[model samples]
Target: MAISGVSIFVVGIALLVSVPLSQQNEEVHLKFSYSGETGPDKWGSLKPEFSTCSTGKLQSPVNIVTKDVIYNPKLQPLNRDYRTSNSTLINHGYSIGLFYGSDKVGVMIHDGKNYTLKQVHWHSPSEHTINGIRYPLELHQVHIADDGSISVVGVLYNYGAPDLLLLQIKSKLDELAKEACGEDEIAKIPIGHMGTKYLRRGAFKYYRYVGSLTTPPCTQNVTWTIIAKVREVSKEQIEALTAPLEGSCKSNSRPVQALYGRKIELYNAMPNKI
Candidate 1:
């Protein structure tokens, strides 16, 4: 089932001009111009249809301060496919075809009905905004189910203290190219071994919306969830993730969009029982 009316991307010819993105061209490998010409700012300028970006309201990446949230919706877990073995290597930048460690963390909610776990990806220096502030990085866990509904789980990272799991992955990043394996190889990565409890702890807030990829061919239909807390990484760690190999762009983050008319949800004001 399709989530947004817009067709999901497919593996096509390399529009990357650089990294290997996903198996497909439009997947996550396309180059994004963040400013003028082919950049993010120029997207709407490029096409009349893209006017929404500059005009439409309800943009994503709201800040996470405490708010009074009333109703606590009961969330159900569906089928989980999280596994370290699920990791795969895709070209993101010139030298950064890093590895992604996704081992179906378990379908938190899925039925042949609404939202189901699709896949997840990451964005350096975050692609979302929180109270007009931006974080260092954001992890987007995209979920789409039966009839075209979308829900995303967002994990935010901050400066300061570093996370072991992340550091571990960072340590092995140099080996990412060697870590590249087909689906079977990905199936061997250990996701469950890494602790995720820290991710859900504390005053975790979220922001939801119907937005598109911050990058090129920016297709919409994404329900975002930006976590309030931030994870830490050293300057060296950040370098590991951003160091473009040979010929490539230095940064991979998209600039923040001005909020238009989207209503922000201060989800989880009340403590959720895990």
Candidate 2:
């Protein structure tokens, strides 16, 4: 009886430990910050485990100052219907991100290869650096290939004429953010031609870099393509985006970091005449 009791106690402790570890192995909802335990300062310190947050030198969110160079205007992004579902709002870390959509980006060959669009999200004041300069807002359209490799096309935003797509989605943002969206309701917010064209024609002054999400899980091995031309959003749009939640008031961009010896390449060519 004594031996059996000891064995049962050990098994109970083992189950307790494994449960939390399994959960941590997967993504969890996290809040954003710039200061303490929940702040940017603690991103790398929350656990002895998250050291990559502090020590990885190739961090993102860099500055961009356009260089006098041309790019391959011929390389236009492919167009396809990006399906989105319900989305979840992430406001605790980085900037505000409303994650939804399911598909990955890649080439689809009827008998060859196809890429599916996976998830889409955004960063305020932008998170990508073009030739070393940053912009106002950057939207990341992340896709996955059939083989599981990841490719991200980043769209930069600036102040200009109001984007019709923004006009369409802006009104529903507060509501869409109420919870993580499911597949059935994804079509409620349609990504139309204007949105598609914006992704294709925005700017070719992009930088192809190897980096991680500016947020936690800090997943590396991501291919980043950041567009240079920015589309405009009204001040009202910016204000609406940056407004505090029911319990907090904070800007959602990740702090810019040093280049740390990364090489930035530009496709020095000319834009094709349309």
Maximum-TM-score candidate: 2
Candidate 1 residue 94 Cα shift, in angstroms, is 7.9
TM-score per candidate: 0.62, 0.65
Q: Please write out the lDDT profile of model 2 over residues 34-79, one tens digit for every residue.
A: 5455565677776554467678776665654445333443444444
The candidate that wins on lDDT is 2
Compute the lDDT for candidate 1.
0.45
lDDT of 1 by residue, 43-137 (tens): 55555645545554443444433342223344232233443333443433322332333334444443344443434445566766555567776
Give the clash total for candidate 1: 35
* Root-mean-square deviation of every model: 8.6, 10.7
Residue 177 local lDDT, model 2: 43
